[model samples]
Target: MKRRVAITGVGLIDPLNESINNFFARTIRGESSIRYFASKGDPVPVSIPAVYCADFKGDDLLGKHRTISMDRFSQMGLVAAFDAWTNAGFNVHDRSHKPNAGVSWGTALGGTRIYEQGLREMWINGRERLPPLSVVMGMNNACSSHIAIQLGLGNSSLTYSVACSSASAAIGEAYKRIRNGEANIMVTGGSDTPLIYGVIRAWDGMRVLSPGNEENSPSACRPFDKSRSGLVLGEGAAALVLEDWDHAILRGARILAELAGYGANCDHVNLVKPDSSGQAAAISLALEDAGIPPKDVGYVNAHGTATIEGDPSEIEALRSVFGRQAKELAVSSTKSTHGHLMGASGAVEAVITVLCLKNSIVPPTANLKDIDTSCEGVRHIRIGDSNKSDLKAAISNSFAFGGSNAVLVFKST
Candidate 1:
């Protein structure tokens, strides 16, 4: 028999350092953390419109000794994971082993900051070597390994690096593990820090980074708007604790929502361009997996990155899947306020979706005033709009550059 998966806890490390509650409140209120960010202590600094946690002092939070061996990405991941674990009522001080519990994390550019720093030290400062434990800290799996070790999760420690879909894919797989009865609990989510010089230069070359002056930076990411430019890279982490329904009930845990379905598919059409058919297929698969009719889904946390093509493609896909009901389905992209967290976007958005269901409030796409003609059909939730409908289910989408599409379905418990 297939076991049911429940979301017992959720946490996030956003640019504003807001707790999960504050984040949701501000998000639905259309507040933005995006700003004009400039790199420091580098010969060729990068200045871009982005969302960054300027107050995140790793050493102060994680302790200087514990953080000495970790990269910024791993530090954020561990903090987010630990927050989720504790929120789930798990004892962080308990070092006891749990064979049925595990961790599945995701990151696209894990430890890139460390590598960039090392290269800078070698080339500019004439240093022959990097810091100690650089290799262990720079590995993509380092975050997952650290979470498992710190939490004493022994069932499995896995990581996925599928660009934007990384987190959703990781969450989906963890849900599958619990649903398949292979595990009783799983701590799953994703983290990414893409503000390094190299990463920025690469994206700048692609001409996909949003442009904004100091006055306009906060509204840079206007998804589904006619004046939309491009995506703004953000750095942070988010985590969710997925537990077996029976196990959570036995422990008297507070279940937040049900991770009902996960659908992942590849477009195979283009590397950068999105295909509506493939996206629709994935959404259809997720609804089928959850045994939920399209009409039952009241809201969608769209993967609307405000790109020239991505925004419209996602709307078309939703219309194809939901048909006439798509016209009434409330849809929004929280990326407008949080910016794009890249690999961690899915987890962050998933956490927001869970909160939306819990509070019965659907957040709007911030800074979206004029809707683009090509992105019509759905009930677009604009900034400051109050949506207190009895939302039964919601979908969060994560479509990546490599044609990877991951859709997660959640329902009120």
Candidate 2:
């Protein structure tokens, strides 16, 4: 028999707030974290509205010496992983390696900020002027490597870069390893700091970013709404501590929820566009993995990026999976408030999904004033909170740019 997995702890370094309680409270209030900013030191000047982690101080989480050599993305991941470790009642500085513990992290644009700065220094100045640790700081696996080193996890350390589904894939892969008896515990999630000048300029060229008006910048990301324009890029990291159910019970750890199932697939059709059939297949596969049917899931955390095509495609996928019951399923996209965190979105949303199961309350999809006709049937959680005493299970969906999709099923513990 497969071992059961329990999500014992979770952590976040998001734009809304660092503390989980504070973040959930702000989410319940439907507050938007999107803001506008002007570019600095670029060949061409640009202005755009995006979600940024303005309050995160790396030195505060990691000492000044440790953070000096770490990139912003790696720093965020380390902070979040440390938070999860502490929250799980483990000492952050305990370097005593656990034989069965490992790490799996994901990132799409890893260390972009440091890479951009390195290029700028090389171009504007001389080759010798570049930072000495530039290569180490800009590597894609730097975050996961740093996390494993800090936590003394020696079993395995892996990284995934499946665009938007990166984090979800990491967590899902970790879940499988534990269930298959390869490890007893895993530190898993994703992180990305893509708000750098070059990264934002690339996204700007794609024309998928929200064009916010100066008067109402906070309301720019309106997922599933009729006036929804596009996604707002955000930066952050989220981490979770997944343990074997028996191991958690043996240690008397507090169980937040059970990771009952995970499903991942590729659209194989378009790079930027979503395929409804592919999404539906992933959802069905997750349900099958969990040994549950469609009617058993009470809530869905959507991959609603608020783009014109993205929202409708997700709605169609839900319709295909839930059939007539789609009209009654409580669905919401927290991106409506926190903006899209890119690679870290799935991990953050998974934390939110587990919280929803534990608290029995569904967070509102902020800024959804008018639901589009194409997204009408599904019951979109709007402006106010909805409490369901019988809420038993929830699914968090993540669809990425490479046509990759990942869905995670969480159940009340």
**Tens digits of per-residue lDDT for model 2 on 171-248?**
999999999999999999989988888888899889899987666788999998999999988898999999999999
Candidate 2 C-alpha error for residue 111, in Å: 1.0
Estimate the TM-score for candidate 1.
0.98
TM-score for candidate 2, please give it: 0.97
Off by over 4 Å in 1: none
Pairs clashing within candidate 2: none
How many residue pairs in model 2 have overlapping backbones? 0
Which pairs clash in the backbone of model 1?
none
Top-lDDT structure, candidate number: 1
lDDT of 1 by residue, 90-180 (tens): 8877866479999999899999888888888899989997778999889999999989988999999999999999999999999999999
Candidate 2 segments whose C-alpha is farther than 4 A from its true place: 16-18, 127-129
